[model samples]
Target chain A: MYRYLLHRILQIAITMFLLIAMVFILFRVMPGDPASMVLDPKMPPEAKALMKKQLGLDEPIYSQFIIYMKNLLHGDLGRSFYYGRPVYDVIMERLPNTILLFTSATIISWGLGYALGKRIAWRRGTRFEHALTFMGLLFYSVFLPWFGLIMIWIFSYRLGLFPLGGMITPELWTAGGAGIIALVLDVLHHLALPLFVLTLLSFAGAMLLMRSSMLETLREDYILTARAKGLSEKVVRDKHAARNALLPMVTALALSLSFSMSGGVLTETVFSWPGLGKEIVSATLNYDYPLAQAAFIFLAAIVLMANLVADIIYAYLDPRIRY
Target chain B: MSFFEIQGLRMHYATSRGRVKAIRGVDLKMDKGQALGLAGESGCGKTSLGLSILRLLPNNAHITRGRILFHGEDLLRKSEEEMRRIRWKYISMVFQSAMNALNPVYRVGDQIVEAILAHEDITKDEAKERVSELFSLVGLDPGRAGQYPHEYSGGMRQRAVIAMALACHPELLIADEPTTALDVIHQKQIIEKMDELREKLGMTMIYITHDIAIISETCDVMAVMYGGKIVESSKVRDLLRRPMHPYTQGLIRSIPPLHDSVGRLTSIEGEPPSLLSPPRGCSFNPRCAYSRDICRTSEPPLRQLNGGLVACHFAEEIPWP
Candidate 1:
């Protein structure tokens, strides 16, 4: 097991290196002059040259790459020309918010998707199954931002039940620890709209996939053998059917985790929620190359880590898998 | 009264296309301490018969007609709750492919103890003792009971399954091709162990298998099935010496002899008729060499012969070796 883990870690290191290299090259090759974007066009040429030299944008592409790699080795991700702050500091400050939002959404969607998928599989050909299938398809077909907007319209505008945007209300910010609780509650209150929209959009495909997988697993001879042993229906379903069915879902979850982080950009922007998605978008629009590069690296790391974790979980769940 | 008797038992499966008659009207009785073998080729419904006896058919299938009496109680009329109480307590089954029959995550001993604890109000320690006893009863090392199913060899896994079946000391044990997945040597050993256990425990058994030779060796009375009906049933030795039904005769002739340089073994001419739209007469008539006009027009009823039942129109006319 230790050897397998070591091998996986080594492979992840190589992958992360390639990912960083690719992102760095792509950002450089893009049609944008970071130096000109940072400095005002009306500024004197001499002042612009000094600013370009200071940011190391005046160096040759190859030399710039070497300097970037050296700084990356020392854990220096460079400073953001747009924010006038260290790229690492900005990312670190924003990491918790994105993690909190995406983590909750991931857990909720996976849990609901698995439970609903199993129910659909069990009660196949029933009205409830048909309704859920249709609803899932309908929800997923709409764009994420549009879905978020619809949810906001229904819950925030018409019903006036939830906060329309942002994490917390002004009153909650000034109230102390009770203030913090109120703040969290307010955040969660506002969180419901976006969370629900994201879950509805992402959960359908997983539910469909899980339902098919479970149906296939149910038809396996082993499951029939379990039933013939006089095991209760619940036992047969949970222990025999669910365990085997969850195998493919584990792989799906890993791939989805990576894609989900990147895919939340539009939803985060619509909600105006301070997350990596919004951060990356604003950085790209402003041509903040360092900030954008840092965000890309962070997203890549998350995806790579999610995949690695999935591999480990897969090996644990099924002894057939190793490294 | 017989320990277990199935009267007028019938089962049909509802498929997307139409209803398929899986088990035609059938009757069987097993006394205590006797092993009755239900023998047939694949899809002949021997396994279904075994499962129906336990009320364990899949959702698509239902027992349309029958009374299954276990110890004078009507099993077919019992509620699901009552059936759950009876299952693993009085009646248990060892399924085919015993290797996969067990849960891979659980230890073999715990699985047996689960079967025991589900039926009886016993402490964990007592259950553990019983599990070890069961393991030893099936000729497995008691020390290896803690190991998971994957840890054991295929033969050992089968022994573990047999151990689980015997945990509650069930009166009626149905083994559905118990050794079908094992190597020849393991198959022989498993069959021998089953025969020994049956004698030691004095339990009635319904052994389902496609191999007539294996059934002949282990069963007291053997029934040959075609399509979904039992075409012939008699003492194993008598049926082997004098198979009455043409299908049975064909089955016996198909068994390749180990010593003789036999020419290509005889095979039934055509596939078994589809149960969805079975032939009007005997289901085996299409493949029977002695099939005649009556064989095509009228279904043969299971009739009493000298010492057993034969479902054939020309049972008396067919000459034997």
Candidate 2:
């Protein structure tokens, strides 16, 4: 087990290094000059040159890469040109909001999907099962932004059940009189619409995957053995069938972190939730290369970690999995 | 009343093309402690009959009509809850393909313990003890109970499966091709083990296999199935010595002799009839060498022939070579 862990960790480290380099190169290849965005066109040529030199933009690509690597090793992600602050601080500030919104959404989606998928697969030919599968497919295929808007329209605008958008009631947050618990509750109230949208959309993927996987597991001979053991239908389905079916879902659940991260972009935009996804988009639009690169690296790191966790969890769940 | 009896049991599988009549009007009876061997080619419904006895047939397969009477009670009339209590506790099964019979993820011991705990009102510790005993009963090492199915060899897995079937001291054990996946040496060992267990426990057993040789080694009574019907049945010695049904004769001839000089081995011609639409008369008429005009027009009914049952119009007329 220790050897396996060492192997996986080494794999992750290599992947992380490659990801960091890729993020750095992708930002450089994009069609934009950082200096042009920061400096005015009316400025004198020499002033612009000085600013470029100071920013290290005038350095050769390889030297810039070396300096970038050096700074990265020291935990510096450079400064955000737009925020005029450390890119790390910018990401740290908004990271919790994204994690709060997407993490909760993902866990809830997977749990609900697994339960529904197990039920539908067992009761496969029934009308209820067909209807749920159909609805799952529909929810899965729907446009994310449009779905978010529809949820906001029905639950927030028309019914007045939740805030229309944004992460908080600005006036309430700035009022200074509310307690800490109230402030947290206030954020959650604003989170309701986007969370619902993200959960519903992602729920379909997990449910469909689980349903098909479970359908396959039900055909295994052990299921017949389990039934012959005089186990109740519930035990046969839940313990024997569903437990085996859950193997593939573990990988899907872990991989979903990356999916939800990309998904976070649209979800955050639609809901105005101030998460890393929103920060990444705005950083990219403003050509804040350091912030965008750092954000991509962070996302990549999380996805790689999730993949590693998936492998470990898979090995733990299935005894036959050697590594 | 017979210890166990199946009367006119007919089972069919619903498919897109049509219903596949997997079991058709099959009647069988056994006394307590008797070992009955069911021998047939693949898809002859031997496995289906075993599944029907346990009520373990898949969703698409339905037992259209039957009365499975165990100890004078009709098992077909029992509720699923009642069937659950009867399964494993009364009639357990050692499934085919031992390689896949056990769940891969669970520890082999735990799987057996689960079977014991399911039907018996035993604590987990008691169930584990029973699992250990069962492991040793099937000639497996009790210490290896914690290992997964993948860790065990194919023969060991079959033994583990047998241990599981015997976990609750079931009155009847149905072993379907239990040795099919094993090597010849393992197969012999398993057949010997099963025979020894049957004698030691004095438990009623139905060994389902295509190998008549295994039946001769382990069974007192042997029944030959064709398409979905029991075409011939008798004492294992009597059936092997003088197989009456043409299909049964062909099956016996197909088994190569141990010491006799090798000759051109005779194989039964043609595939087993498609159950979706069986031949008009005898299910084996298309494959029978002695098929006649009447044989193709009327299905032969199983009837007494000497001391045994044979289902062929020409059973008496066919000359023994």
Q: Please give the distance, in angstroms, between residue A193's alpha carbon in candidate 1 and its true position after superposition.
A: 1.5
- TM-scores for the candidates: 0.95, 0.97
Candidate fnat values, all: 0.23, 0.94
Question: How accurate locally is residue B259 in candidate 2, as Cα lDDT from 0 to 100?
Answer: 81
Write model 1 residue lDDT over A1-323, tens digit each, in one string: 78877887898889888888898888888787787678899999999999899988889988988888899889999999898999999988776667667767777788888888887987788999999989988987988777788888899989998778776676667765674566678778878877877887878888888899999987776676566556677877887788878899998888777766663777777888887778898888777878998889878887878888888898788755555
lDDT string for model 2 (A217-242, tens) is: 99999999998899999999999999
Model 2: CAPRI class = high
Candidate 1 ranges beyond 4 A from true positions: A170-178, A258-263, A319-323, B258-264
Worst 10 residues of 2 chain B by lDDT: B113-122
Tally clashing residue pairs in candidate 1.
Answer: 0
RMSD of each: 2.1, 1.5
Winning candidate number (TM-score): 2
Residues B1-321 of candidate 2 have per-residue lDDT tens digits of 999999999999999999999999999999999999999999999999999999888889998897999999999999999999999999999998778989999999999888888877889999898888888888999999999999999999999999988988999999999999889999999899989998999899999999988999889999999999999999999988888998988888888987899877799888989999998988888888888999899999989998999999999988767
Alpha carbon RMSD to native, model 1? 2.1
Interface RMSD of 1: 2.4
Candidate 1: clashing pairs of residues: none
Candidate 2: segments with Cα more than 4 A from true spot: none
